[model samples]
Target: MRKKVLDVAEEAFQARGYHASSMGDLMATAGVTGGALHHHFATKKALALAVIEERVAAAVEETWIAPVRMAPSAREGVRSVFAAVAAELERQGFVRGCPLNNLAHELSLADPDFRIALAGIFSAWRQAIADKISADQRAGRELGTDPQRFAALAVASYSGAMSMAKTAQDASVLRDCLMGLEQGVMSSKAGTRRRSRILHRAL
Candidate 1:
């Protein structure tokens, strides 16, 4: 029953902003009595916090963190995630935007708890990507770039692309953004390698 409420609530929050999803709407959608809803979550804010900590956090972990952490390289992981997400948006025939990102934009300024919860998830996501980049840098694949900044760029690119895609109702925007980002990363890496070789020979 708690799970049911959380599941439906997450869907509602994602589709509609937090402020717009009234308690009555959630109760009706979950088919739970007001008393029962309060029994699990004392307030709508509590429910939203639960969704952020449980559902939203898990979604980010599964969708971004795990793949980035386990992939062969940072660039490959990011590229694959972009490709997979673009494909998924196409298959779903709709771009509602990323759930975490959507909620963050709407609720980050609404409450301290909401801001903290959303920031934690974003931090973990960025850290996962940054860790991957740092690993690659150790192996000489990524050079002359701060791992954290690069990870932030990747996150920003995807988030902005999703927002644009949602507005355009086109998945191609995501693919197009990914292409440009990948080219930039590759170009910078190659330039770094050239400078390194030159310095090594001069020494």
Candidate 2:
């Protein structure tokens, strides 16, 4: 029952935005009475927090953490992560932007706890990408820029693209953004190799 409530809350939060969604809405959607909702989550804010946590966990698991766990190489896994997100957006017709991002934009200012929770999720996401970049470096894959910075940029760009796509109601914007990002990463890697070779020759 708790899990059902959380699941319903996640969908509602994603669709309606955090501030716009009420506990009553959640209760109605989840088919639970007020008493049952109170038994599980004492207040709307508490339920929102739970929804944020669940969305963060699910996003991390689906995008970065789980793919890395299953794939042969961290780099490939990271690619798969972004690809999966793009695929989802395409399938859903850009109706739902990222849940964590949407919630953060809506409720973070109103709720400090919400900001902190979302920040943790974003930090974990950036760190996972950075870890993948580090793994690529260890495997002799050249990344043209600082791995940590590039990782952060990639996550930011992807999220921003999703937001823009949702705003424009055009999925092609996301496709173009991701394609450009991938090309930039590749070009940067090439530049890094060229600089390395030149420095080695000078040495």
* Tens-digit lDDT string for candidate 2 (83-198): 77777767876547777678878887887898898888888877776777677777776445566787677778767877887788766666677678778877887887898999
Ten-residue stretch with the least lDDT total in model 1: 141-150
Q: Please, what is the whole-model Cα lDDT of each candidate in the order they appear?
A: 0.92, 0.77
Candidate 1 lDDT tens digits, 23-82: 999999999999999999999999999999999999999988999888999989999999
Which stretches of candidate 2 lie above 4 Å from their native place?
Answer: 72-75, 143-145, 194-203
Clashing pairs in 1: none
What is the Cα-based lDDT of residue 127 in candidate 2? 78
Q: Which runs of model 1 end up more than 4 angstroms from their true locations?
A: 194-203
TM-score of every candidate: 0.93, 0.86
TM-score of 2: 0.86
**Clashes in model 2: which pairs?**
none
Q: lDDT of model 1 at residue 5?
A: 98
